[model samples]
Target chain A: MSDLQIKDAVKSYGNVDVLHNINLDIESGEFVVLVGPSGCGKSTLLRMISGLEDISGGEMFIDGELVNDVDAAKRGIAMVFQSYALFPHMTVAENMGFSLKLAKAHKSEINEKVRRAAEILQLEKLLERKPSQLSGGQKQRVAIGRAIVRNPKVFLFDEPLSNLDAELRIEMRAELIQLHKQLKTTMIYVTHDQVEAMTLADKMVVLEGGQVQQVGKPLELYDDPSNMFVAGFVGTPRMNFLPAEVVDVSNTTSTLRFAAENGAPEVVLPMTDGKLAIGSKVSVGIRPDHLHFSPAQSGDLAIPIDVAFVEELGDLTYVYVDTKAGTRLSSQKKDGRHNHGTTGYAVADTTSMFIFDADGHRVRA
Target chain B: MTDAIASPSALASNRRKIKVPSLWTVLKWIAAISVAVVALFPLWWMFSVVFAEAGVPVAVNPRLYPTSFTDGFAKIWEVFEETGYLRAYYVSIMYTILTIAGVLLISSMAAFEFALFDFPGKNALFAVVMLSLMVPLAVTLIPTYLLVAQLGWVNTMQGLVVPGLASAFGLFMMTQFMQSIPKETLEAGRLEGANHFQLYWYIALPLSKNALITLAILTFMKTWGNFIWPLVVSNTREVYTVSQVINQFNSPFSHTTVDVVMTANFLAAIPPILFFVFFQRWIIEGVQMSGSKG
Candidate 1:
């Protein structure tokens, strides 16, 4: 059985639903990330699991026990907040041991536990300093230490690294992975950043508009996203979408063609999945890395585009172009032949692109 | 000169700084000193009268320095012999301490609940507290006195302290300060196994140190110097606070001794003055530091 299970969990404010029918099973010692854009209900779902929010409907189970009605403190779960939330007047050791102290544990036990956690986080020397005296990174370490001392079954991190500088955030990400490996505990982290989600999580749950769009391993989601939103939201220099239509259908095979604005020679690609009607509107999504320059006279499909600008990074280059279909697409290429203020053709291999139906659901199974 | 309308006084001050002794500067200094002297003259005059020897007429020109300093100590001795001077100090100190304890407990607890919790009727209840501030203390005096008498607390310390404990203004100030603390801090405490009272006692109270100190000073000073409540409640020498005994020296059975009255008054003002002198920094800096980000 999974260590934590959320079965048909729903959360709603007065009259409006934030998350509906959420079903998730977090295995023991798995690092899961709930990734979404702002207002996508990832934080709300994490809060519900933490018992900080009331689940409007459905049930939550932790370690095979129903915890929907349990108080947050008794739920045996620990969370690290984005703001650090260390008590200003308390020393770092006291803040870390506060939970054990409130439990009326023996003084020696509390000190030992706090010391162990401090050693893990390398905060033993700063035990006597108050939260106000510590730098931002140290404060963050103390917050994590506060959770670590609890030895909780599952750890919840609500964008714990969002407040740090970029370099520190990256450093802390590696530290957190090390922490997870050492503890061997189930951890659920919430973030709006796909890059952090991709780097940190063992599994990713993509959410949009309060609904879980997809859940899989990070690279699995990156390679084969279920739909348009996940496909676009998961990658950097995001996927490019162009309009396409089903031209003809035969037994177990169908031909599709692009709907370019300007009349241009096109290659009709045939697929084995014959689940398409003739002349149906569809969207074609292809990653910029998949696009390649073909011979001038011939390619799978030639896209007439106006080159707007080119970004020349030392290792790579991004060519931004406006298509004849009036869609702005950026292509990633390592060769930095950046012609300023010039028009160029953007070519693509048709079979590499994903085709979506009118409902934005993938059609090429 | 470039921004003439924006800072004409600044420009004038710059021009005046050019090694010039002008008549207006001397007159400005005179006006400022006059205001300061006017504000502080009563305390100086009280000391002067208290120090003057018994039945010796005060100087015609009110003096800033006391004419005879040792007589003030002698007059205080005489007043203590005649009236309940020592007993008055005891009553006043106890009354002030109890009053501060009661008010701070009630107000801070109420303020914490108001700041942290969501319940029905919270806003309406706070509004009622605010509305009660508009009612003058005099209007409630008779009813309060009757209630105290009915409770068999007449001439008791309770009558002097309890009725003035739940101050509306103190509750309002405390609640505003409590609200300024970040909500995440309270939530952290809650998740750390703290109940409502624990949250208030441990988290809210510790974080609100500055506001609590300022409140303690204000409430202590106000209760120590109170006159009307203790006057109406305590009818005998055993229960008289310092301020009540000071009132007794005004006439003392038809023979008015102005010097004794001044001496008693001077003695009574010492505790509150010393309190303010030591803690005046908290009263000002507390307000400034409150709600500021770390």
Candidate 2:
């Protein structure tokens, strides 16, 4: 097992840089999930670490040895590709044992390693089958088995579960977590799915536009996002941001005003330190689950909302609404009928509101 | 449910209304067979003439079948006794084998390089190879003959084999086939500690067997049947390939003896036919590889 370090790593194709100044330290036995949208250079970063791609700049160290110039095999890393890429002509046993055979390992040792991997993956019955004969999930298992046989210092997975169906993706996510625990090797997994990053990562790095947006524990980034991009990207159903203006300021509270009908009053945000100037623009951020409807208010601000849509997913309901300013809003509804129309409106209390300045930075108390 | 009760009467009327194309099917079969026979008649006629006596005229219209293989053999023996027929046959086979082998080696290696690697001027080099394919071999004949003469390879197998080795068509075909092989497979091998040579040997070479076989068969048949290049390159009977030497028995200006020439031609055709029979499976596989759905 080894810790992998990337210092000031950059990649450029000719003049245009695809990855810019990427610096990360993955400790031994840590599962670091690299989550990003497509074209964010996450896969390219992984490939550079794996030595499959040439690093355009900076140093890479694996196990305290600089490996920027090392070949993939010599780097002691294994990768499971999104396409599986199992040798179509080779049987499962042959595919699993290929690396060992190439290294000129003894026949008995090759068989022993292959058999153990097969047993762990429940692939003993599939040892005789070719890749074409296996289903997608089975082929992926064979791919992982191929990786497992190498027993590398680090395992790189490039969207390994993206090809699987939703149910299989969930099942395989658990299997991968279990595999990481059992092997306890430094593993870097790349995916676009936030759920995968949250569930599978010991540490998560979210990237956008070839740059790291934030790097921290999953809950840390979720609870406190540094910027607007990380805030909107790190959560499910996404954190909602509503546009508003500061109407009145006080020592402990500030009133944010938006156009409303005669029955709806303007919402006030109670800040620990009154920090806003009147008439200044601000954005209010809210986690959907933070919003709760109350008949009698005991706290700050309440805004009447016009419910636009509802998604009732058995355990919880997501209510899509428009604020009094006609800004689109989403809030989690836990009780009563899960309303599913645009016309019927409801009220959510002030604690749900997350205020931001004009720059989309969150306003923290 | 109501329709089920009335279906037998309705079905009887529907069956009466339907007109099967049994007569048209028979007519179509007749037309197809006629076309096939017309296409294959030259091959059949060549076989028939190969077994007829040299002096006896086949017929004004030609015989559908030959009299006997023994008569044809006797005439071919007469021709052989008069000239070095067996020697020519030996030279032809040797030259064809060498040419095919060299073409396979050169073309496959070039194709592998062109298909797999990205170096400086790789596309420009590939474009040059494609450009070579557009140049007619006939146009290069005189220059090739002079080059062979300057090299002192005239009347040698080198004259026949060397110039034709790096066949542009073979290179193009093999490159297209090798391109379809997923790059991931090669990457997988590389990650497994297989070096460049090992990757080519263990993954590329084995997987490209179909394309190689297709190129080999096509190259062999083409070299075996090539006439003008070998004729222009070789000055003596000692270096004549089967195609060039088979014309030696024909007296085009006089009363031509068909059987002696046909028998030699018939025997000359057997090697390529045998080659094709052995490698037909590879041809289909090659075509299928080229036809992969996007």
Candidate 3:
């Protein structure tokens, strides 16, 4: 019952606009993640929805009620801060029961609600300990417990697990997903971590410079990005962009030549709708995971590369490569492409590559 | 090991690296103790005078110590018995407690706003509070007295306590101390459906237990030992505070007795001393706990 609709929402400090025309409709029980790099306005958008930050313009509705002018508490939203924001003086049970007590609930009712949340969080044993006595992971659980007791319409988490260590962060991330499923409530989580956005979100909104770049499911954004920024930001180890020039165009296909070492010929790519004109400067994008070592030195489709470094992460190896013309790119070195030397590694794969115009808008290949 | 291998002079000069005191260090301790003793000699002299007989000849040097040690105790008991000095003691304690309670309420509440909230002219208003700290009480004595008289509270406890409550110094200390507390904690309180007052009462107050204790100590000591305000505000002996009534030993209506005044001074010093000893743990525990806060 906690669906949220934000219409033409804008946020600014004086004349300096920080978030521009943000429009989103979140369905009930959906886990939506607003994610971007630092200063990209994800936190601001979350704060606005939580009613912590005032919306400079436009409307916000939560649970079919216009909440733009409502106080944070009355808006039926609970926010978990990055710092956890647990009351240090109160024990775990008291912290969990604060909202209920403030609502003037009876002592027994408060205790029952607190006990329920503690049991769910597995914090029953630590109920008597203060926030300072708890470990980092334990503190975060208590923070979530505090939020759970309220049973707010929407749960707003502002990088709640960013403070945890990497291993703990992974563990907490999985737990948060499970918690959302168990509660069957709408949750809006904000983070700059793409991995968090990809893994935890049912739908991900990628933002950059205070504007919505793209929004889709995790793999949808990964497989088919709307623009160059979305393509570069959504994937891990990122997609590579190389300077490309259109050579010859016919009815349905265009021959494209990319910047490469001397004597590399052009490659053929199928084009639709005649979107790219001949001699137009464009950028070619290749995903690291999508790339394979193309069959041995086929044509100009293969660029001569010198290996800069190799990062082996268990199941996959990422080879950092720089073409001889100084165009840098990374390729997934699968199927024994482990040639590391001064000799140029001629590599190319046209099976799954992207093309973007000079304006950074993607033209489907 | 690196510290042990360091040069002798370097190690001696460095506080962290220093192992033991050298010849120079022993001399420094002796010098510091000498300065402290010289500074405390006046208090010792006052205590000594409390023991000497009350009616000793004015021209002669008083006996260093009376024949009976109970002379000071006996004289102190007589002052309470004969004079209204005991009532003065009661009045002082009552008003000092009231004044501190009022000041803590007003200052901590106001400071919470200044530290956490945003509003128009916030800095300008805060600057005015800061500026009041620089204006000495002496400068406002006449106008303040006139206002107290106008209110017809000249010799009442309210006039005495109310005028001195809400000090800029206390407000500034509270604001700065509360500012050091992370804003996220209070914001959490807000999300818990707590309004500004509840946030102050529940989150700010509990988090600032040390600061409140420290401020309470300062306020209690200041109002307890205050002289001029009480003297000017109250002329009736019934309303006389400890500091004001002690002047009566100089013989306002009759014979002067330095011994009883010294005894009063000695008794006055006791409460503050006990107060410090009781709450010194808070004063010593550096204002706050460290990083473990969520």
Candidate 4:
């Protein structure tokens, strides 16, 4: 395994810049995921690292050597495309062994490497099958097997699981994690699915519009996002942003207020400093799980509400409350939970709420 | 129960009433056979003329069958020995094969380049190629003859084969077919460490077998019957194509030996007809499929 470093990487088509000033250092054996929405230039960045795309302005170092001008064949990197681009005419084994053949490796060595990769991917039975004959999951495995047979220092995957069905996507995700553990090669994966990024990556880079929003472990990003985009983008059901005004600020906490049309409780968040003066505006952030329903005496103030809806998934139930603050918000709780009241605990006992100013930057406490 | 039974019976009667077009079926067959006969009349007449005797009267009244064969196949063989017919056949065959080989090589390379790579002046170059398609081959006749003469290639097979090696139709057809191959396939091959030559040889070329075969068949046929360029360039009788020789069998004011000439003409048609029969499927099915897919 070899570390990869990219410094001041920029990609542009004529005047329109697609990726701007991207800088990252990935350690050897690290599984880093570049996750963002479509057109975020994450795939372009991965292609650049693979040397499939020309680097417009940047220095890229692989194993302590600059490789920006290297040809894709000389870069010693293998990629698994989202389309599972197995040569439709070649059988699975031939597809896996194609790179070795191109390198003029010994035929025996090529066969041994291909067999090993097939074993690792559980594709021994599929050696004679063409891509058109295989299921989507099987085709994906062959694509990965082809990459593994190259035995490159770095492995790149461009949304390899995006084409599989939901159940197969989860299965492949687990298998990929296991594959990484066994191979321990430096891997850079690009995907628009946040769930895949959170589950598979040791270090996740959330990009938006060609810029990195946040780079950290999954939970660190969930707990402390650098900005509102990262906060809203990194979570499921998304972190609810309630527009509030700071009513009063003390040494340790601030009382916040939002119009409670359905008799909902006042929005209150704890603050470590008096950054916002009285009557100043701010936004309060809270996770749905952070807000749970219990007896009115056990938690914060309660207000009457007409139940909007409920969703139960065996272990937990989601309560949709209007709060009558113009838009509705959801709270997750144990099943058989009914609060006839709108108020619930803010997140949890251990989870602290987030606050952001008007510019969508996190208000540092 | 009676109501349900009556409903199904009534539905059956309604279906039978809707099926009132058996007369259309009979008319359809009549129309189809009439069209087939009309299309085949020229071929039937060619056969009738080939077998008719030299002295027998083939009337304008149109006898449906042959009367006799005084010249028979012997006269075609005599023509084969007497005139430039044998050399014409050989020249046409050689030119067709050579043209097919050149078109396959040059046009496929152009197609792969246009389909895969992005370079400066690519669109302009491709536009030039498409512009060649729009320009009729006849417009370039004088210039091409002058260039061939300057190159000292007149009356040589090189004069016939080299000028139109990279056929615009072949390039256009192949480029369109190659473009239909997803970009991911090429990128995957690149990531597999295949160089440009290897990608072309092992991936693009193999994947484009249908289009290549189609272009080969069409190019061979076009060159086999090519008269204008061959007639202009090949001043020697030894270098004439079948089309030129077939024209030589004609005389405007004299009594042309019609049966002997027709037999010779029929024999002349055999090579291309055999070629078409052997390879028509590839062009009709494979090329059309590739073009539509692109």
Candidate 5:
């Protein structure tokens, strides 16, 4: 029953508000990731949940108890910082057993718990070594071991993988998933890396400008985003947005006309309840993978583009093209072709397209 | 033919490069030797006077080296017997040890607070502390002595040790060093249920070992050689430090010989010299750390 809830939480410094009206819930054993770009208040919200930062307004509950004023140590939560803040003078065993030692637990009990955590983290061989003697990956493992020894009701991770190298980050990402399955504590992790969020989170939260843009399962946000911000932020290389004008509206479909310089393309998308008036400006959003270099099919929209550059990433290549309207778009290709300086047609699947009005709000049919 | 001709010139150039030092290198050596001679000349003169033959008239015919070890040592024994030199040594050692302990503990704790925590008047209070450094010590000496006298501690160890414990330079140095410790480390301690004092003791204190050693050495050297405060406070023979006793020999009323006076000065200087010799590395390291951080 180690559920956590944050109700309308606000964080401010003097009069400048940094986090505005954040509300979230975490059930037992669920992995939630709060992700956004730098300064998006994701780290601030995590600090508030960990009780390191004070909540300027609203309530926080852990295990059904309001904990707005509780001390950070008494909140029954452990955090693994991005810096892996292991005491440099203490050995691995001593660091893992620090909280227990502070609690005045007996020597044998502390030793046993530390030993167990070391075994779990595969740190038994390095128990006698200091942090300065360990590698970056080992130090991160010891930090996790320290948290595991506490057996807190919840775990907070603030971009813990940001310090590791690319190969080691992938390795530790897998280890974190395994640790979550083994421990089954309610974990709230924060990061700005969408690939990490997509792979590790049971529920992903997208935040921008101190506000949560959307919160849902990773694929749900990817497949059916609630707003243009969520659609653009959730995927790698970003989704392509093209400006268009609504030309006509029927009972079941709406026709949009792109600029004449872009092959004068017209796309008629399915709409059950059309509320858009003619001559209204809108942007059509499509993921990079949904755009293909082949010719258009029955219901696809085709637009001419100049291939600006191609990035060949072994198994997959990314094609960055410039449309005639001076819009730069990226499309993922699996053929690993080098099509630089070649003008080509990009066919966009209309079924997977997203439509947004001038204010960046989704217009669902 | 061109290769053979070029080889000899290249060889000659390489030989000249190896044999001739740069003008900058020559100037650096000259400057270093000049400073060394200026610093060491006084020490050599002191030793030359200490070991000169009795009634040798060293001022008229100064010897660069010792004339006789036996006369110098015999004079030292006589001075020790006549002037309570051993008791002065004990008193000076105790004063230096106690003052060093007090200064390190007080200043390091002050530094931890000033560097790590935030309070209502944090910046203003630190500004005041920094301002205290600007006021000359001579200005405070009379007032401080008057306060000590009013407390009826003119000849007490507390008067000697307590008044000098709040070192502005030490607090400033230590605060700079402590600020370099990552705040995340202290926050980790906070999350582990450690209080402020525990954090200071277990975390901050251990991390500040180099700065502490550096401060201790500086305090040790300063307190060991202090003469003015003891002269102002200790009018009795029992509380006299080595520096006071050394000054007593050079006083106008005393008839102590030059060799005996120089012997006392030489003995009083050995502890500081040995201390500097032993811990010079930490002082350099601590200074570099403080420099970069500050």
Candidate 6:
């Protein structure tokens, strides 16, 4: 295992920059995941770390040694691609031991390493099978096993679970977590799936427009997003954003009212910093889970809504409703009693509400 | 008893419906058969002339089938002894083998780079290569012959094999095929410490097996029947390809009978026929894939 440092890394094609000044420090044995939407340079950043793509600018170090010019093989990095990328003509054992064979290791040693990797991945019975004969999940296991047998300092996964079915993806995700624990190798994974990022990452890096948006522990980013983008992107069903204007500001609290009409829902949040001025426009960000059908306590803002739909998943139901101003929002309910086309109030908890200013930066105390 | 009788009638109706072909389907089959017959008639005529007795006027008789198969065998032996047909056969086989090997390797490597890599002027360079295909081979024949003579490759196997090795058609087809290989597969090889050449050899080549085989068959057929180039280069029988030796039977000074000429042509056509018979499936598959991809 090795620590990797990318310092002010910039990747550009001709005059257009794809990734800009990306600075990340991945500690040894840490499972770091870079999560973002498509074309956000997450895969590009992973390729740079693996030395498959040129850095274009800035420096990279592996194990505290400068390796900006090192070849991917020489960098001691192995990558598992989204496509599985197993050689179609190669057997499972050959695919696993390809790196060792390329390095000209002795045949017995290659076989031993391949055997160990296969055992770890539960692929012993498939050692002689070609990739074409394997199921999607088995192919992915072989891809991961290929990386494992390399004994590389770091393992890079470029959305390795993206190709599997949902059930298999979850199964593989759990297996990946177990693999991380068992091997304790420094691994950097890239995925557009936030659930995968939240579950698999020890340190989650949220990226947008080629720049790092937030980097922290999974729950830290989930509960305390640095920007509106992270607040919206880090959660399922996405966080709801309502246009609001600061109606009143005090030394210790700021009151915001949603919708321009009078008697709209209003909430007061603790803000000792006095950053908001009266009549200043801001967005109220609330997660689906944080919105409740019944207010737990007084002082929660209750917004009147027309129920658009309800998605029931056994113990919980997601109530999707449209506010009077026509902004759609989703509220999670444990009682699961909500129905379509019903008029009711969904309470937004004051303590859980996040306020972002006109620029989409989080408003903090 | 009434239900059983109704069942037989229903089954008979269904069978009658299935057995009758639509007029459009019949027309398609008729058109296809007409084309097949038109394409195969020349071959039938060649075989008929080869099997007819020596000095027999096949054009006058217009026989659709062979009259005497032994007559063709006797004429083949006569031609083989008199014209050193075996030597020409050896030359053609060697030329085809070398040229196919060279073409597949060179074109596949070139296609691998063209399809997968990015460098300055890549599109422009590929455009130039494709543009060369537009220029007729006959247009470049004189200059190419001059160059070959300057290099002292004329009258040699290299002269026959090397000029056509960098086949634009092969490269184009292989590039289209190679482009369909998933990029992640190559990158995986790169990460596994395989160099570009190793990736081409181990991954790209295997994945392109169908395209390679298609190109080999095409090159085999073309080089086996190659006439103009061998005629221009080979002044002696030592380097004469099968096509050139067959051309010897048609020369005005040779006084060779029509049956001997047709027999020589029949012998030259056998290898390509067998090659096609074996690998026709891959040829069709390669053509379909290249068509869709390109």
Q: List the residue pairs that clash in candidate 1.
A: none
Model 2 docking category: medium
> lDDT by residue for model 4 over B1-294, one digit each (tens)?
255456787888888886556888989999999999997777777777766666553565655566555555666777788776888888888888988899998988889999988899999999998998788878999999999999999989899789979788889988988998888999899888777888899999989988888788777767876879988888888778888877777756534577767776887878877876887777578546645321
Colliding residue pairs in candidate 3:
none
Instruction: List clashing residue pairs in candidate 5.
Output: none
Task: Order the numbered candidates by lDDT, best leading.
Answer: 6, 5, 1, 3, 4, 2
Better of 2 and 3 by lDDT: 3
Q: What local lDDT does model 4 show for residue B13?
A: 83
Candidate 4 i-RMS: 0.9
Predictions in order: lDDT: 0.84, 0.82, 0.84, 0.82, 0.88, 0.88
| Minimal lDDT window, size 10, model 2 chain A | A292-301
List TM-score (chain A only) for every prediction: 0.95, 0.90, 0.95, 0.91, 0.96, 0.96
lDDT of 2 by residue, A108-140 (tens): 999999999999899999999999999889999
The candidates, ranked best first by DockQ, are 6, 4, 3, 5, 2, 1
Candidate by candidate, in order, the iRMS in Å equals 0.8, 0.9, 0.6, 0.9, 0.7, 0.8
Clashing pairs in 2: A283-A356, A285-A354
Each candidate: RMSD: 5.4, 3.8, 5.2, 4.0, 3.6, 3.3
Model 6 over residues A1-365: C-alpha lDDT tens digits? 89999999999999999999999999999999999999999999999999989899999999999999999879999999999999998899989988888889999999999999999999999999999999999999999999999898999999999888999999999999999999999999999999999999999999999999999999999999989999999999999998899999888999888876423557788987469999899998989998876422234788776778889887889988887878888988787665434776778678888989999999986
A14-73 per-residue lDDT for model 1 (tens digits): 899989899998998999999999999999999898888999998899999999999988
Over 4 Å off, model 1: A262-267, A293-298, A336-341, B1-33, B57-64, B67-69, B286-294
Identify the runs in model 6 with alpha carbons over 4 angstroms from their true place: A247-249, A257-259, A265-267, A294-298, A339-341, B1-72, B286-294
RMSD to the native, candidate 3? Answer: 5.2
Per-residue lDDT of B1-294 in model 2, one digit per residue for the tens? 255465687879988987777998989999999999997787788878877655444566666777678987776776677667788779888987898789888887888788987889999988998998789877888898889899999998888789989788888888887898888888888888899887877878778887877777667667778888878888787877777767776747634466666777777777777866787786566546545210
